[model samples]
Target: MLINVCNLNNNHELSTTEMNGQFVQSQLQIASLLKMETTSTDQKEFICKCRELYKDNKTQLHFVDEFER
Candidate 1:
């Protein structure tokens, strides 16, 4: 059996599938660092709450406060 994936391009710019995959993997690693058993769970309540509080906040400021060293 074989699976095929097609790259979608928009406005002459190719979508960065490789970069997206890497970003997803990085997110999984971050989730693991949080001791999360699954990325999708009610345990994500904390993330939801934080988003609600800072939805318009710049990520750089938040990341420096939350994760970046």
Candidate 2:
């Protein structure tokens, strides 16, 4: 058995915000970060936000697949 994982953020240009708010290694996928949705209000919890200009569709999905646990 084998598994593959990729850090999509490794390729793009990192901005000051993404650099500071980076929640994972190096940074996050420009698209994945842009599409993140949260309702938290605290500034300290301001994570998963992109450049606010990232419009890529790579991480966009229609439905979340649920698995039986």
Candidate 3:
């Protein structure tokens, strides 16, 4: 249900869904970006960091994920 974009530039692109021509804009759902088809390197690193930070929790991510689904 999501559209993918392919850009060849260092600058952040504008969101087509909102702020049509805005730059440096970020979506509110950064944590779930890892599952996104267009996730950037920074988003992957941020997700990795979040995983490490809460990795010690007994419930664990996998369990939470399955439960969420």
Candidate 4:
């Protein structure tokens, strides 16, 4: 897993496994912070945020596979 933490906070440095753990921890933290075990509104907001972030980051990744060959 070629995880990228380039957008993470300045004080953090995460390896692949650490990055995976961080992702799980992030979902847990978000759920806890919102004080919900499961809620549609919370889920929707989280999904939207993730989608936007993914799109932004994906655009930044100019992989060789995407080049005009």
Candidate 5:
């Protein structure tokens, strides 16, 4: 699920709040994708790849949250 936030003005700039919301939404979408892929794919390699991607994204999210606070 891609969440697109459009600016009303021509510049199309996103505020900090909007950016953060997008990040969170993207993370959730990634997690959902991982869950779906895990159930559909029986390959261990695919599952490991999904888990690594999830972990990387989760770490980035936490870092951003900490930096913001």
Candidate 6:
């Protein structure tokens, strides 16, 4: 259950169960937001906001996993 949020353009890893749960919830929220009948520009703005939130809360970023190809 090691989810790599960075792979999804995030800067953190969902290492713990709690963090993973939050990640899932965040993803669901993003999906719901995207589903709204908004303009493309608004969708992009929402995505940027989500990314900023993740980036600000990220603790372990820019670390390369040697085993990952």
Clashes of 6: 0
Q: How far in Å is the alpha carbon of 54 misplaced in model 3? A: 0.6
Q: Please, what is the whole-model Cα lDDT of each candidate in the order they appear?
A: 0.55, 0.39, 0.50, 0.56, 0.59, 0.54
Best candidate according to TM-score: 5
Candidate 2 runs further than 4 Å off: 1-28, 47-69
Residue 3 deviation, candidate 4, in Å?
Answer: 22
lDDT tens per residue, model 1, 6-62: 334442463567657756776776676669455444435555565667678887448
Which is the better candidate, 2 or 6, if ranked by lDDT?
A: 6
What local lDDT does model 6 show for residue 37?
85
Which lDDT tens digits does candidate 4 get at residues 9-58? 73356677877777787777666666847677766665555555566576
RMSD of each: 12.8, 13.8, 11.8, 11.0, 10.7, 12.6
Error of 1 at 33 (Å): 0.7
Best lDDT among the predictions, by candidate number: 5
Sort all candidates by lDDT, best to worst. 5, 4, 1, 6, 3, 2
In model 1, the clashing pairs are none
| C-alpha TM-score for every candidate | 0.30, 0.21, 0.29, 0.31, 0.37, 0.35
What is the C-alpha lDDT profile of model 5 across 4-64, one tens digit per residue? 4433453447777877777787788768767774433455454455555567688765654
Encode model 2's per-residue lDDT on 1-69: one tens digit a residue. 112234356536877566566545334554565577745452323222321222353442111111111
Query: Which runs in model 4 stand beyond 4 Å of their true positions?
Result: 1-13, 36-69
For residues 1-69, write the lDDT of model 3, one tens digit per residue. Answer: 232343336344545554433322333334356466754775566556656765887567675445434
| Whole-model alpha-carbon lDDT for candidate 3 | 0.50
Candidate 6 lDDT over 1-69, as tens digits, reads 123343454435446775677778879877876687867776566556555555755542222122121
Candidate with better TM-score, 3 vs 5: 5
Q: What does candidate 4 score on TM?
A: 0.31
